[model samples]
Target chain A: MTAAATGVRATARIVARDDGRGGTSLPVLEGDGPLALRRTRGSGDEAHVMLVGAMSGPLGGDHFAVRAGVEAGARLRVGSAAATIALPGQAKGEARYDVRLTVADGAELRWLPEQLISAGGSDLRVTTHADLAATARLVLREEQVLGRVGEEPGRLVSRLVVRIEGRTLLDQELDCGPGAPGGWDGPAVLGGHRAVGQAVVVRPEFEDRPVSARVLGEGAAVVPLAGPAALVTAVAPDALRLRRVLDEALKSLG
Target chain B: MSRAALLVLADGRFPAGGHAHSGGAEAAVKAGRVTGAASLEDFCRGRLHTAGRVSAALAAAAVLGVDPVRLDAAADARTPSPALRATARKLGRQLMRAARATWPSSELDALAREFPKGAHQPVVLGLAARAAGLGALDAAYCAAYESVSGPASATVRLLSLDPFDATGVLARLAPELDLVADQAVEAARECVDAGVDALPAASAPLLEISAEAHAAWAVRLFAS
Candidate 1:
């Protein structure tokens, strides 16, 4: 309950720069506590990195963060080894995870993390902020599973904010599980669905020829933002179905 | 300033083009999620806390003298569906015309000139409230009440449900409307200092997804 008792305060930082041979390389890879970073093999101009959870955490009171930057002409792809599960801990305070990403001009970043499962009796808050240059390309995806199989959810609040050239492209928050405001799981909100996911694609090419807005399926939709980006949002009865909806939408975006 | 202004702005027949849109209720009804008064109440409650809360906060902020341009951008940020954004702007434009003709304030005129096409409806609603001499809480109440009322009224026509039942739904939600309006005022106060980022960002994913689908409906009763 106290600030000191609130778990670990750890941050992982990564920097990707141009290799000058038509490729990209990571010069800075640092992670602390349970937030482990590993650079894996990548082909061509893209560098691949996988986030390996050093330990089971993001439990109650735990504080974690990941920061990544891609310089001009460099490309980086980040993924997780497995799903990040929020678990209840000894402390009563909620856990916090912050992801800050930056892509400079002519740079590219693909941030595709696995689902975040909010287990029963656990509480977590996640904030992901991405700042991109006008010419930067980004493919960011987020998926959340309310609770494990045959379990009730705790509390999970997630916020996603994306900006380009100092202008707001998209900013939204979703609060689900226990203690959230009323009607969150009702017909107009989740409609009894347990899984929710969204993908955002931004490219300079979209500025010239924008993506048309349309409904993907019964539970998904793709809509163009004010900037050169498109957002796909989908909700399903389960994670597998949710991924199917998002994957189908991504293929159409291509 | 005057309490009567809230009544004028919140009236369903204000000619702001809200009659054509069901605020996502049409899609819910078609999806079979809303079968009767009970389901309608459930749907309206969800909408009120999410989309309704966001709108009330924006309107309250506008009445508190926050810049309309900034609030308009903030509104755009909260609304992900292009169809919903277009609908908001169209309604904002219509409300701007009515407000300018009725209240005739310089701030409203300036905002109209700035956004020729239109701004977001909540921002315009706040300015309209201010133009009519209403306060922040009043603007918040108007926005919060309208969020549920629009859908309730639309459902009566969509399902041919008894009008009395629909009215009862709104009546039962009156207490929640007061609570949401108070919360909106609190958020608007934060916006006055911390900027629009302080406003609530609660979202209704099903509504956004359904609105996109409804927009493509070759034949539908409501516009959104």
Candidate 2:
């Protein structure tokens, strides 16, 4: 089911402000676009923001640029409302998603987007660039499902770059297409698996999260970077199983 | 420009220490991914396209006079696995020794002095290419070939599959490798004016995950 090639260019931004005299949490800012931000107040200074896709999932040629900022002394929890399905449209047979995040000192951002489902004949590129302060904190999770159950997988090229004080802490990329090159089908790669997930966490307390998590997890790889930077990546047969495993890994950090 | 210099720098037996690691093939083999020659070809092909392509582009970009500092960061971003990062650094250190000895370039000496611990392997390969008067395509070919060659040689020992069969797998992949190297050089050319972000970053999550798995193994024939 191909939709007409609609050049969907959408931008969403979130800036957090510390709520003084905080008994109940309140949103600082909200807006609408192809994707929107809905603040779900948490306790104290922390607020939860769920990203809602205003329209159907992005089709081929759709471009999305999402920016998020957490002001000093404020905390934000970001989530995606639902799964994003990628279909090849007329826009050169590809779609692109880019996210930029800034975490100020004494602030925190928990970014957990729901899984992205890519159908056969789909090509997508996602790049995440994050700049952090010495005293700031960030937890980012990205999950991808190749194709629907009993369906063929699509192509995805994803990159994540995180820097602290102008120094790169974690920089990585994953490119997978059902049968494209780069060894997704090889034993060294996905081993013919269907789903892959990754998470980047930078909290003061989880310094050894990478190596420690390896001892705790089944087949996942955790890598700790300079300072508080750490990441975990894994491949599984299905989305649910991968998510469950990653959720547990994320929890183990605390 | 110096084809002979390129050959000498890119040789598998350059004694730069590529032999110590299996390029993550050890993990794959243990996971039962490469059972025979057919599977081995598929594995190399995937790497040639993804990691291999990225490495080649990084090397090419370095040869084109792009700042090594940024390219080094770009390499880090492209590589996710901790174990793989360590292996690349080790290989880079070894290559640095050999490149300095063979080429005797002050730039290589400065790089060695800057990264006393070591730099990433592909970054060194690019600098080495520049010192050797080789083109980006040459560096890309060297990096691309090395990406698969390590695994192929390691599989021969792990599976004890026929050596002739393994060599034939590489032989058949020659054309695809040429194409990948060409594409890598093309991508690097795009980054001449822009930043290194234009380079290809095709990655393999399982290759990275399994490298971590392989590193923790109490006992393994080849270092990852």
Candidate 3:
């Protein structure tokens, strides 16, 4: 019920509305408790909000809650300057973040948060819940690296739940770890690859896309959801390779 | 409650159409994640705790008289893969037919009518357990066993792995199976007052991800 009960409490909120000149502008820009948002230059109907971490990063025993909204006839693009590096806190526990997003009628939002780098002794949980109107459109991309550039993978978990017009569309929980938190092997999860990315596109009355379950290149594959969602989970030997795979997925998503 | 009924439900040859799907093992085998018996054991252990654990909880909750529709939504929330979701509903239909014939119950008939297309496999498994006069623990056992048994049987055919080794893998997992089943029933009991959110949502994304890849395989032996 309270942020203190969970851990160190940190929160951010962003509210954007239409500007009448065929674009959108941020009217409620607030952050930096732990996450800071900056407006970036953009063209056409796109407005970018780049996230900046205020602290060294999320340490163990840290809690973050981010809330964003796109009003009617507005377009909002969400991204970050760099990937997040999760480290253990003084208490040596898990860091958790809860994200709540809303897309009003005729609004569009693109969420492409950078990959998360999980360090050893790190336990991280990120959950995002989206409420969309029937005429709203959303593109959500979440990527994660199990361990640091060179380290043993820690326990990382993320859960996403989306509701369109009060109807549940996507509800999934993913855990990445060395063991215990649903340990990974060569076969069932990432196939020995330490990186995975999941993307979803929700648009009402959208036609079926040709992307099904096909490997993008060496270690990347696109796992298409039944409806408008395209679930892509790609794994590479290293983080660099994983970034390439994520880039390819972005193009494929295009 | 009838242990015989639990066995009848847990039996691999229960005619629930489980034989058609490899439970994502086919995908893992092709990816070389499950090369032999050892890796397969690891895979099964992860499943027994994650997806398998979640399924057992769902079944157990159903046996505890939780609303099937709400449980079905919770199942969707737990399952992130579209392919696996489809497989679950298909298996639910198959199990419902067997349940209607083997143990006639008005509840089963009504479930069949409501979810004519199908609900979810775990939800149906739980209802079937209730109809057969089984308890929550029995339902958990039935669902947990199927989670591993389906893959173990499929591996013997997919990689031509030694059948004895596979059975040995199951044997090694017997203790863990008991622990997970017990945990599932304990969680189910709380749902009686706390609602379906009390159910565990643990999942293996790779299993759901690989199920998609397995579904796209035109030459694969298993449907999922």
Predicted structure with the largest DockQ when compared to the true one: 1
Task: Kindly list the per-residue Cα lDDT of model 2 for residues B51-104, writing each as its tens digit.
Answer: 888899998888888888788877776776667778888889999999988877
CAPRI accuracy category, model 3: acceptable
The whole-model lDDT of each prediction reads 0.92, 0.80, 0.81
Compute the DockQ of candidate 1.
0.87
DockQ-best of 1 and 3: 1
lDDT, residue A198, candidate 1: 92
List the candidate numbers ranked by DockQ, top first. 1, 2, 3
List residue ranges in candidate 2 displaced over 4 A.
Answer: A1-5, A22-30, A88-92, A204-218
Q: Model 2 over residues A65-176: C-alpha lDDT tens digits?
A: 7888887778888888898888777676568888999998988888899998888888888889989988889988888888888888778877888888777776666677
Put down candidate 1 lDDT per residue, B74-164, tens digits, no spaces.
8998999999999999999999999999899999999999999999999999999999999999999988888999899999999999999
Off by over 4 Å in 3: A1-7, A207-228, B186-198
User: Number of clashes in model 2?
Assistant: 4
Task: Sort candidate 1 into its docking category.
Answer: high
- Per-residue error (Å), model 3, residue A224: 4.9
CA lDDT, candidate 2, residue B123: 87
Looking at model 2, the pairs that clash are A171-B77, A175-B203, A182-B46, A183-B46
